[model samples]
Target: MSTPTDAAPAQPGVRKAGEDLLTVTDLHVYYGNIAAVKGVSLSVKQGEIVTLIGSNGAGKSTTLRTISGLLRPRTGTVVFDGKSLVGIPGHKVVGHGICQSPEGRRIFPKMTVEENLELGAFLRNDKAGIAADKERVLDLFPRLKERIAQKAGTMSGGEQQMLAVGRALMGSPKLLLLDEPSMGLAPVLVDLIFDTIRTIRDQGTTVLVVEQNALAALRIGDYAYVLESGHLKQEGVARELLKDDSIVKAYLGG
Candidate 1:
């Protein structure tokens, strides 16, 4: 497997004209007899915060899983930084500069906060770079710096969520895939998490986020897609979607 040192150019050979840093075409993912993501296609520009917002069972998470290589697509292509990510393994996907903070805060329950972060940098040989990124992540979440020696599973829900995002940052992903980062958080924590996401993009990482908190997600996002029952229902600039009556009434609680 390629390590982070083998870091491919951030973008190369692909179309240099458009803003697209990652593109998915006719993507499809199936679990046995059921297809969770059905022929979905989308593009995320470099350094832009794009969101996929939808109700449960709408295939938002499945689309994200497929892109991060946790599940293979039955059909379609995932192009990231100009490389086809069709057959890469999940770990290799990270090496390709894509990392995900998966749904449900899937942190290492038995590991210390620092240990979990070290795991995220397992592919990088540059110890100094890893340490620097760790420090930067901690700066972004000072609450985590205080809990460095604590067990990940014992932290508060907000702390655990911060740890998840921090772990993904330890690798310095060029494209970050976040799955429902606000799933069960208190409103205040939700705001903090969303603010952190904006900071991540501001620092130049392209983001493709899936969130059920439609309003909050779109409010901070540059673009948004609305999905329903494994199909795309609507898509547009985030502010425009926020003003669309159908979108506001259907997904934003009217």
Candidate 2:
């Protein structure tokens, strides 16, 4: 299994530019004895928005966890850039430019908004760059600037979700993994969250998004995968999946 450490720089026409920023092949993960992800394979290309859509408990979060190094897969390969990510530590994964805005918006409740954002840059040494990224995140989500001094726990659900994304951006990741960014928000806030995702992609970061809002996710994504019981059920361009009758009826609420 080739790892990101062995990955070569983008070569001209070797395959194609911007293919597979992250690639997981035959990945299998377990929780103690229970296998949560089984032989799952997927890819996220550079600067593309790829969404993994499925019902709850369908191994969506587990897949992200494996990629982020939160859970080590029992078998399979995760290659980022060009090297394997299998044995990398979670924190080290961030340094390699993969950062995750986990599900449940797990912002530090005790910390002020700005403090939480600062922690996101703790591993980075470039003071000026950190300051600049902070400004950019604040600009992207003005509500965050307004609540900079407020405790993260005290903010509205939507605001906390925004802060989670901003904090991940603070790490200046090349690849961003988002888990259910639209969960538990009002319709308006959901729209805002999805819009922010689009803005993040436009800024040149590749994105692997896991979303329960299948309709919205498919609409925004460039490519998508459907998972069931930890296995790959389908894969296609997002538009193609959206138009699929079974997908439309089952997931899109059509």
Candidate 3:
């Protein structure tokens, strides 16, 4: 395995053109007796929305977990910019400018919305920048601004989902990893979340979103990889994949 170093400078929510911000090669993850992910490989270029879409139990979450360093891969490499993150811990991975808004919205349930958002920036000491990011998050999800003082656990599911994404943004991540951003929500709210994802990419934060909503994910993505039973089945430009007959039949309900 390649050794990781803190050689890459943090860009703080900005991305440079033509640069590969993240790369994973032949990743295999296991949960003791289970092989959750097998031989998965993918990449996210700077300023692109690269979605990993699959059904339940397809290893989408496992792939994201490995990249975030929450789970170690049995065999693989997670390279961020020029550094290797093979054995880096989750907290250290955040310091490398990759922040993951995990599945289940994982907000600090007992803490107020404001507090949870602040915790996302705990790795930083720049008060002014953190303040700016907090305001930006509120702008993106006005509901969060309205409920800033309310406990996160009390918010509606849709509201909690918004808060989750907003909290990740508070980190000013250069490469944002969003796992299941719209898992359970009404159609209107799902549309809202997908739109916000595109807007996030437009604002220069490269994104790797893992979603079960194949059609929506493909529509907003710049590129995409389809995972099935812990293996990669296909990958291509997002728009092209949308038109693919096989992809439509298998995942898009076309």
Candidate 4:
């Protein structure tokens, strides 16, 4: 298997465009007897939005879980900012500057919106920095600011999704892992979520998104990977993939 130092080359003329921040090489993960991720290798640069676009059950979420330390890889390496994150506990992953807004939002339903956002900074002690980040998140999702005292579960699905993204931002992540941010939202909210993702990237947080919304994901991503049954099938500049006949037909519903 290829290691981080000697992984296979990326697609021709599709080299990573910025400084490498996260590198997953030859990653293999399993659930009991089921091999979920098979030798998946990908990279995220310091200031780019890279997306994994694939169908359900394609191991995209499993890859994100492993990178966030929620699940351990049975083999291979997860190197973030040059340090191996293979055995780091999930909670500690936040301290290393990576945070995930998992699929299904996963907010504390009974908690107020503000309370839920506060929990994201549990690992930090820098009061001023945390306060600044809260304000930043609120700015990014002003709807959240208006509903700060409302119970999270009382909100609509789109609102809950915004809160999830905001909560992840409260952690002040250098690399944000967003899984299906547009899931279960109305068309308008989907547009808003994608807009917010671009804003997040413009504001300096690199993002690695796992999205089934292929067209929308490709629109905002600087680069993209197409995964099929736990293996990489295609990868290239997002615009290039968007134009590819095969990619459009298979994932973009062309």
The model with the greater TM-score, 1 or 4, is 4
| Predicted structure 4: lDDT | 0.91
Best by TM-score: 4
lDDT of 4 by residue, 54-165 (tens): 9999999999999999999999999999999999999898899999999999999999999999998888899999899999999988999999999999999999999999
> lDDT of candidate 3 vs native?
0.89
Query: Which residue pairs show backbone clashes in model 1?
Result: none
| Number of colliding residue pairs in model 4 | 0
For residues 169-243, could you state the per-residue lDDT of candidate 2 as single tens digits? Answer: 999999999999999999899999888898888889889999999998987787889998899998887766767
Error of 4 at 69 (Å): 0.7
Runs in model 3 deviating more than 4 A are 1-17
- In the range 26-124, model 1's lDDT, one tens digit per residue, is 888899989998888989988778899999999999999888888999999999889999889888899999989999989998999999999989899
* Residue pairs of candidate 3 with colliding backbone atoms: none
lDDT of each: 0.87, 0.89, 0.89, 0.91
* Cα TM-score per model: 0.92, 0.92, 0.92, 0.94
Task: Give the Cα error of residue 201 in candidate 3, in Å.
Answer: 0.7
Candidate with the greatest lDDT versus the true structure: 4
- Which candidate would rank higher by lDDT, 3 or 4? 4
As a TM-score, model 3 comes out at 0.92
User: What TM-score does structure 4 among the candidates reach?
Assistant: 0.94
